[model samples]
Target chain A: MNVPLIARLAKKDVRVTVREPYFFFYLAFPLLMTLVITVALGSLGGSVPSLGVCQDDAAAAYLSSSGAVDVATYPSIEAVREAVASGDRDGGLMAGEYYVLLYAGDTTSSERAALYAAVSSALAAASGSTETVDISVERLEPRGLSLQVRLIPFLVIIAAVVGGLIISSSLIEEREHHTLDALFVSPATPFDVIAAKALFGLFLGMVLGLLILGLNGALTSALVVVFLFFGVLFTIGIGLMAGVVMNSMTDLIARMKLFNIVLQFPALVILFPQIPSWLGMLFPTHYFIAPIISLTQEGAALGDVWWKLVVLVLCDAAVLVMAAKVLRRRMSGMLHLPSL
Target chain B: MTVDNPYKVRNTYVTGYSGSAHVMMIEATGLTYRYGDFVAVDDISFSVAEGEILGFLGPNGAGKSTTVKMLTGQLVPARGVATVLGTDVSRHPKAVHERIGVCFEEKNLYPRMTVRENLQFFADLFDRSVDVDELIRKVDLEKWASERAEALSKGMQQRVMVARALVNDPDVLFLDEPTSGLDPVSAEQIREIIRAEKTRGKTVFLTTHNMAEADALSDRVAFINEGRIVALDTPENLKLRLGRRLLRVRTRAGDDFAEEVLPLDDDATPDRMGALLRAGGIATVHTLEATLEEVFIQLTGRKL
Candidate 1:
C-alpha cells in the first residue's frame, strides 16, 4: 500500500468531517452524553441519607455527633412520627421505654432495612453494649469497579462505535457523489482507499476512547489502550462492511440500527450483574468490555486477562479481514458477491 | 449479413499527420462488455493516434461511456485486447492509469474540497507535481479557486473536473461528455481547453452526443448506436458520403414569394437555375449541404 496516498486520503476525510456542522454531534455527542450521565449518577451517589431524631434521646445525640447521616431533630416524639410519615426524612429514631424505629409506609424494603440497621447500631452504642450479628459474610474476591466507573469502558466503546458509523457515512457519501470513480481513475489503488478509510476510523476511535477515559478519571494501562484499539477496529470493521453493503445513507442508517442492537447489548449486560457473562460473550464486544473492566477496575494485569485479550484480538482480526475483503470486492466492482 | 467497413469505402484525408507515420496512443480490438445478459458495448474496435481528438459521437446509452471506461482502465472488457499508452490496460491498469486522465459525465469532484484542493489531490495521486494556479487559470476557474466544489455552479464544477483531468499532464485524456449541461460560455471555454490540449500534442478521446461539438472539434468522428459503431471517418467525409447536394431558389411569383429545390449534381441543374433567374423577380439563391446530424440519421437510422 502507498502510505503517502493513504495519509492524504485520511487527511482529506478528517478535514471534511471536522468542517461538517454536525461534527460535534457525530464525534463529541457520545462523550457529552457520557459526561452528563456521569455527573448525574455521581450526584445521586454522593447524596447523604437523612434521618429525623428525637431531641431528648441519647441515641439521637450520638447519631447527630457521628455526622454519617443528615440529622434532623424534632421537638417531640409526635413530631418525629409526623416527620417520618410526611416523608420529610428517610426514617426516624425515638428513645423511650423501648427503642423504636419509624419509617414511612411506602418506604422500599431496602430503605427500611437500612433504617433498622442504623437505629439498632445507634441504640447499642448509646447503651454501652456491644452486639454482633450471628452470620458473617466472607469476601471471596476483592472489590472491583463501581457500576458507574465500570460504565466508562462501555461509553468509550460506544464512542468508537459512533466513530465507525461516521466513517461509514463518509464512505457512502463518496459513493453517492461518484467520487469513487475519480479515485479509481487516479493512481491510488483500492487498497489505498480502504486503508485510508480504516485508518480514519481508527483515529477517531482512539481519540474519542481516550477522551471518554480521561473524562471519567479512569485508570489507563497499556492493556487498556491495546484493547481499545482492537475494539475500535472491530467496530470500524462493521462500519466498513455496512458501507459496502448499503448503497445510500438511508439504507446505512436502517441497517446500523440492527447492528447497534447487537453491539449495544453487552453494555446493558455489563450494567446488570445478574445477566450471565457467557451471554455477553456471544457478542464480539463482550471480549473488549470484560477485559477493559478487569484491567481498569479490578487492577488485573495483562496476564490476568490474557485469555480475554486473545479472544478480542482474534475477533478483531476476523472482522477486519472480512471488512477488507468486502471493501475490495466493492471498490473493484466485483459486485456479484452475496450481500452480508 | 455483416455491414461493410465505412472507413474503407470513403476517401480518407489526413488532418493531423499521415496515417502511416502517426503513432497510435490507444488501440482496442473487438472490445465487448455486458451486464448480465444485456450487452453494453459489442465487438467494437478503434484506435486513436497521438495528438488527435477522436470524437465518439452517439446518443444516450450508445456505449460511448463504456468505451471510455474500458480505455481508461475503469472496467475490464469481457473479450478484447486493449492497450493504452503502450501498456495493456487489463494487465497493468495502474501503470496505464498513471499516464491517462479521465473526466466522467457526472461532475464527480470532491464537493467538500476547494477547486485548488481538488486539483492538488489528484496531482498527488499521480505523484507528479502540478501548478494549481496555472491549471485553475487554464480552466478559467481562478475566480472560484478558493470556493468549495459544491458551492460552484455546474459549469464551474465541470471546469474543475477538466482541470483535474489535466493534473498529471497525461498522455491520453478521456473526457466522457465533458461539456454536457453547461452554459454556452462554459461550453466554449471547455472546447478551447480541448483545442489547447491538441496544440500541446495530448491525445484526447472526447465522447459527446452533440454533433456540432464533434463537427467543430474532432479530427475524426465515430458514430455509435445501440452499442455498435455505425460509421467512423472525418466529419466532413461522413457528411459527404451520405449527404445530397441541393440548390434553393427564392423568387417572387405574382407578388407572393416562391421557392424551388433543384439537384445540384444533376445534368439539367444549370438549365433549371438559369430558367429560374431569367424568369426575373429572383431574390436569392443558395446551395444547401447536409449536416453531420443529417448524415448520422441517414447512416444509422437514428437521430443524435
Candidate 2:
C-alpha cells in the first residue's frame, strides 16, 4: 500500500547487491556459462568436408546439391585414390554398381562409412533403380538454430534459478543483520517487503536473461520476454519462501543446492533430449523453457505457444501465493507472536 | 493482581488530568504476553501523558523489552489493551506504526549504506520529505555521514539510530537501551537528545537498566521486576517513600580519620552533628540521600 516505501526498500536492496562481490558472480554466472558453451560448440558449424567422386557425375551432382558434402569429380578410380592418399579431400567416394569409400591411413572409420553411405544413396537416387528402397526425406522447414543457439533457452532458465538464490541470500542478510526488525517497525507491511524483494529478483533475472540472449544472437520478442518473466517469478517465489524459512546464509546455501537439483529437471530434459516429454511436462520450468525455445529459436508466434504460456502463468501464480503465505507466517513469527 | 474480565476493551480516548488537561499519548491496561510455559510480560498497567518521559527501569530479562514491543505493535498482547496516539495497536498496527518511531537495542542498521542514505531510506518509509543533511548534523554524525554504518564505532552507530528514529518527527518515540554501552561523553549527548524530544512535545518510552539515566532523564520511572511493575512514581517520591535520610560527618579520631552517621529525621541528629563540628576535629559534614539504584534494591531485593 505504501508505494514509495516499497520502491525505496527495493532500491536499497539493489544497491546493496551491486556492492556485494558474490552478487556480481551470481548475476554473471548464466552469461558466463552461455559464453563457454558457445565457444566450445562453435566448431560444429564449420564447413562440411569435401569428398572426391570417381567419374560419377550424377552422384557428384546429387552430393553437391544436398549441401551435406562437397563433391570433387576425378576422371578415374586411381585418380580418386591418389586424391585420398594425398589428403586433397577428407575421403574419396567411388560409385559403380555398388559404392566404395577410399580413405587415407589417418582417416577415421566413422567418416569413411558416412561418406560411403552418402555416395551410395546419391548414386541410387540418380540411377532411378527399383532395387533400392524408394525413400524421401521431407523437412517441413529449414533448421532454426545451431547447437549453440539451442543452449540459449537453457541458460535463461539457469539465470532464473540464480535469481532465486540472489533474492534468498539478500533476504537472509537482512535477517542476520536484524534490519528486518527495523523494516517491520516502519510503515511497510510484510506484504510490501515480499513484493519489493520479488520485484528485485524479477528485475535481476530479466537483465541476465536478455544479456544471455543477446550474446547468443538469439531472437527476442514480447512473447519470449513474457515467458522469461514467468520463469523468473516462479524461481523468485521459491527464493522468497526459502528466505523466510531459513534463518542463516549457510542454511540457505545448503537448501539452494537441493533446489538446484529439483529446478534443473527442465534444463536436463532439454539438454539430454532423451528424457520423456511427459516427465518434463510435470515440471513448472518445462512450460517456461518449451515456449521460450519455440519463440526464440523457431520464431514461433504467440498463438503457437499460447497453451504453454497459460500453464506457465498458472504455475507461477500458485508458487507466488504459497510463498506469500509462508512469508506472512514467518513475519508473524519474527514479530514474536505467541503460538496458540 | 488479575482483572476478572481480562479482555475488557476500552475506548481509544480516555479522560485527562484535572488541572492541565493532559492527553494520554500511550495507555496500556493489564497487558500480558507469554512464551509457551514462561511469561515474559505479566499483567501490567501504565500510561504516558503528552510530552512526558516514562522510564521503564529494570534489570536484564525483566520484561522491559516485551512491554515496549507490545506498546509499539511489534508483538501482540495475550490479554489487555494498548493504544498509541489513540490508535489500538492490536487492530491497527500500521496506523500506529506510521506515527511512532523506535530505536531497537540491537544495532539493526544497513551495514553497507552510509549514514545519510540510512536516514533518507527511513524518511521515505513515512513518505516525509525531511532534510536528511540537517538530521545528520543534529545527531553530530556529519563527519561520518558518508561512511558506511559498519565502519562506525558502537557509539556513532547509536547516534545514527537515534537520528533514524527522528526522521518522521514522530509523535511518540520508543527507545530500548538508547545508551546501553557508551562512554560518558557519548551517553551525555544521547541524554541531551532525550531532553530535546521532550522540548518538542513528543512522548518517549525509554527502557534501560541504568538507574542514573532514569533518575536524570525521566519525569517518572517505573520499577519492573519478575515480569511485573513493583513501583511507579516520580524519582524523588520513590526515594523519599522508602529511603532514609542521613547526615554523614567526617572527623579526626586519634591517628586516623573517623566518620559517623545520624538520621536527619531524628530530633537529636542536629545536636549530635553540632557537637561533632564544635569539637574542631570535623573535616567535612554533608547530607546523603538514597539513589534510584538503592531504592530499587530496597523495593525489589535485587540490584539493578
After superposition, candidate 2 runs with Cα above 4 Å error: A43-146, A298-304, A337-340, B1-21, B277-280
User: Where is model 1 more than 4 Å wrong at Cα?
Assistant: A43-144, A334-340, B1-5, B8-20, B277-281
Question: How well is each residue in B1-304 modelled by candidate 1, as lDDT tens digits?
Answer: 2234455322222333334667889888788888789898888887789998999999898889888888877788888878998888877888998888888898788788899988988887787868989999999888899999999999999989999999999889999999999999999999999999999999999999999999999999888878877788888777777676888888987879988889988999899888877778888888777788888787777777
TM accuracy, model 1:
0.81
Model 1: lDDT to the true structure: 0.78
Q: Give me the candidate number with maximum lDDT.
A: 2
lDDT of 1 by residue, A60-133 (tens): 87777766666799999889877776667767776565566665543433344555666667777887889731
Full-model lDDT for every candidate: 0.78, 0.79
Clashes of each: 0, 0
Alpha carbon lDDT at A24, candidate 2:
74
Place model 2 in a CAPRI quality band.
medium
Fraction of the true interface contacts (Cα pairs closer than 8 Å across chains) found in each model: 0.53, 0.77
